[model samples]
Target: MDTVADRVKHLRKQLKLTQTTLGQCAGGISKQAVSQWERGITEPQWEALNALQRACGVNPYWLLHGTAPMLESEHTPSADATPVGPSPPGHPGTCPLAELLDDLSRRLAAADPAVRDEVTRLVLRYLENPPAGARIAKAIELLLGEDENLPPA
Candidate 1:
């Protein structure tokens, strides 16, 4: 990627995460914040970059400097041992919610922009102040339609 904005957008796409999902992965940042980063309107703060590193195994150095090896695992130290961050839980080197978020992102990709925006806002709200489990299930059903593949609520 030529710029930090390009890198951020590429990383988000590589992770198959929507802007909202990526923001959530990066410590509950807003979708608008992610958008601004991708659009080169603003750069990510150090804390957000660190959270992205933890959330998605991004090499923070490469992310900022456009160096080689986009992923943390691909980098090798020439001198002192680099401090390693903890692997994300659920699956090795991945955000716990990645799969669910990817699926949701794909499902919403073809949605009307306004509809998608509204859903994203609702999701962010629910995340901030979570509702009952049944309420969450109902909201998902209402937004994405019933899916036989979804497990029992």
Candidate 2:
């Protein structure tokens, strides 16, 4: 069996990905750092191990010990597609308005990643500590059928 070093190195190579590319996916690694890790000069930090598993869809245990299969049945959901903080109210399929909002967000994201990212950040911030009258104001706007800057209802 290959050592952890060789396994990681081989996996990166088998995907035809440069060390630099793997490093980028690992969040804050550099090619030289990856080279050192692959040569068994050092081991990755716990955080780095998590990042690698997340980025490459490999099992962390396999990456470290090669004792298990590389593929993991469970995977983390994509950042953009997953919700944050808490789940929205009511059953998912029952709310047409919520479904529309999700679909709109997806469409806006497809149109522009940068704008959508900024908008998402803004929305998350606004949601974190919603102003006193924000919900009422939104409700009034919706009742009045004003499109404005809001997503679909």
Candidate 3:
């Protein structure tokens, strides 16, 4: 990400946390403060940054200067290592649907209330209709905007 705001938003998304949730995890800060940080309206103070690092395993240097890894190296899994045993309860590996729902919730939390309601209605409608194959692909393209390189549905 190019800016601290981008990095902060990316970190929250990676953790599947809403702004309020992230704030809570980062030591009980308010959602408005998190929103301001994400919007580039104000930088997080040293105390908040330290709390984020301690509570969320964020790399403070990365959060501040953006020159290092986003997460502490010890908390991040090595790319080459395969997980050996059963995932812990509530872990993303143990419940992919839960993880996805958490991500959706995080996004919805950032949206305007009206937009959130509309999106929920649309999703419910789509679930009922359950578009298939080419229709699904077309819908995805419509939502994401067309990508020329995408194979035809």
Candidate 2 Cα RMSD after full superposition onto the native fold (Å)? 12.5
- Model 3 per-residue lDDT tens digits across residues 1-153: 888899889999999999999998767889999999899998775446657766777866577667657877545546553322223234544322233334445556666687666655554443334333235324433443433433443
The candidate with the higher lDDT, 1 or 3, is: 1
Highest lDDT: which candidate? 1
Off by over 4 Å in 2: 73-153
Task: Please provide, for model 1 over 63-150, each residue's C-alpha lDDT reduced to its tens digit, 9 standing for 90 to 100.
Answer: 7767558887786565454322222233354232334455556667767787677667655444434334235535654777644454
| CA lDDT scores, all candidates in order | 0.66, 0.56, 0.61
- Candidate 3 lDDT score relative to the true structure: 0.61
Error of 3 at 69 (Å): 0.7
Error of 2 at 4 (Å): 1.3
Error of 2 at 91 (Å): 18
Q: Over 4 Å off in model 3, which ranges?
A: 74-153
Candidate 3 global Cα RMSD: 15.4
Instruction: Give the TM-score (vs. native) of candidate 1.
Output: 0.51
Q: RMSD (Cα, Å) of candidate 1?
A: 12.3
- Sort by TM-score, top down from the best: 1, 3, 2
| Candidate 3 weakest lDDT stretch, 10 residues | 81-90
> Candidate 2 residues 1-153, lDDT tens each?
478789878778866789899887776899998898889897665446556666676555567667446755454435453232222233342222234345344445444566555545444443334342245324433333433444442
Comparing 1 with 2 on lDDT, the higher-scoring candidate is 1
